[model samples]
Target: MRQSGTVGFWRWRRNPLKRRSDVVEAWVLLIVAVLMLCGLPLAGVLAGLHVDDELQHQREERQRTTAVLAEDARAWQAGRYARYQATVRWKASDGTEHTAVADVGPESRAGSTTSIWTDGKGELTGEPPTEAQAASAAALAGVLTMGGAGALVLGAHWVVRLSLDRHRAVALDQEWARVGPQWGTRHA
Candidate 1:
């Protein structure tokens, strides 16, 4: 009789990874993972660009407002409590120079430049815009947007991968079934 051990070894070598279909499935899953890793951050950034509060801050730069340095301790304290009058010079997008009185924070220093925004009621109010706020808002928006986009991308990719893997598994099972009788006989 032929050596069963040698025959079994030959059969195993014929399919190293179990099936060629397995290789395909692995590739599909890998692509999905990569896409998920990339997409979430992109979505986050897109969303952040449209944030209303941050946009308002940016637009206020064009509005005119009054700016005053916090003078004495009392004035500073009062300025902190009640929105004090501040004079600010702001340029419109059209390049027109304008000045207006607006409410500002006491943290505003003498000669420190700030943008003033006017309310719909023609009353100007708000803290003197600081580089810190602008920078902070921008950073926050960026981080959030990126994070969201990353999540979205990851989710989508995972879903796609899962579907592909399921299909692959089904196909692999069918193929195995078809080959099963032949392989089983050989083994026996």
Candidate 2:
């Protein structure tokens, strides 16, 4: 009962048995706990906000336009994207026309219409992510930020633990140096 109840007694109680290293380590553990609980979530929130802002900027800058395949293009893969590739032509805001290779679906054929995305220069580009995609990306960013912050704090805690252990070892060596000589003069 005594051993189980005294688990953290050295850290929580004031006694001659509590060395300076013990006190420092206890304070460090408390700080780490606070940071892991508070700072990690804060980092995740900040990262999510940042991702949303960037996605919004992209949504504002990119434009969707109608394009036509210059020739029949077959499916490059059976997936949603890159189902096919073909020379696609679209008009710019100034009525200038441009051509670029584009990913299309199997339904595309010569002279058939399809929607495409373009940049400020009217060059073909990938479409901006939908609201769902933006939200998913934000969520992923938040998770990654939290994980990275946790890893950093955990590493710092490990370093602090190692430093405290080294100090404890040095203290033990010093104490033994003073008491070691007394053992030679003892009768027993």
Candidate 3:
């Protein structure tokens, strides 16, 4: 009693049986499609760019300095990794000496020198990420942003569809109740 391809756009086409809820659902679908296809990707790109800029600024504020071990470092093995912690002394740009415990290689001796990173105030800090690492982080942030936004959009769309379906069901029940007695009399 129905055509195959006609079912695709029935909500958009003119039909006596189509309810106002159907038109609302169609518009919701159109808006969701536009957001998923365009808005989400643009948001992801902006997030990536912001992350990359922040990381680059931090990298510029760090510097590497040579540190000499103040005490002998005994290597300790943890699973397949081995490292030693020893007190190290390093001079800042202002000729002030600073000492801190730092991780060193297993073969390091008391007088051996190793490289360490420092902040603008000559405080020891972690090494700055390389260009490739920063890029990877930015890409990961972009992907996560896109995935999160997509999920939220899909969740909202699902909620709207469910509400519309409920509305249609209620309307159908009301119509059937009004028309049921006539059908019963005709059958009798």
lDDT per residue as tens, model 3, 68-157? 999888765565776788889999888899999888887788999999998888988899889999999999999999999999999999
lDDT of 1: 0.57
**TM-score against native, each model:** 0.43, 0.77, 0.81
Candidate 2, run of 10 with poorest lDDT: 74-83
For each candidate in turn, give its C-alpha RMSD to the true structure in angstroms: 10.8, 3.9, 3.2
Off by over 4 Å in 2: 1-17, 78-82, 94-96, 185-188
What TM-score, to 2 decimals, does candidate 3 have? 0.81
Superior candidate under lDDT, 2 versus 3: 3
In model 1, where do residues sit more than 4 Å from their true spots?
A: 1-117, 120-129, 185-188
Q: For residues 1-188, could you state the per-residue lDDT of candidate 2 as single tens digits?
A: 45777776558786878788888888999999999999999999999999999998888889999998998887677665556888889999889999988887777789988889988778888889889999999999999999999999999999999988998899899999999988786575
Candidate 3 global CA lDDT score: 0.91
Q: Highest TM-score, which number? A: 3
Candidate number with the higher TM-score (1 or 3): 3
Using lDDT as the measure, name the better of candidate 1 and candidate 2. Answer: 2
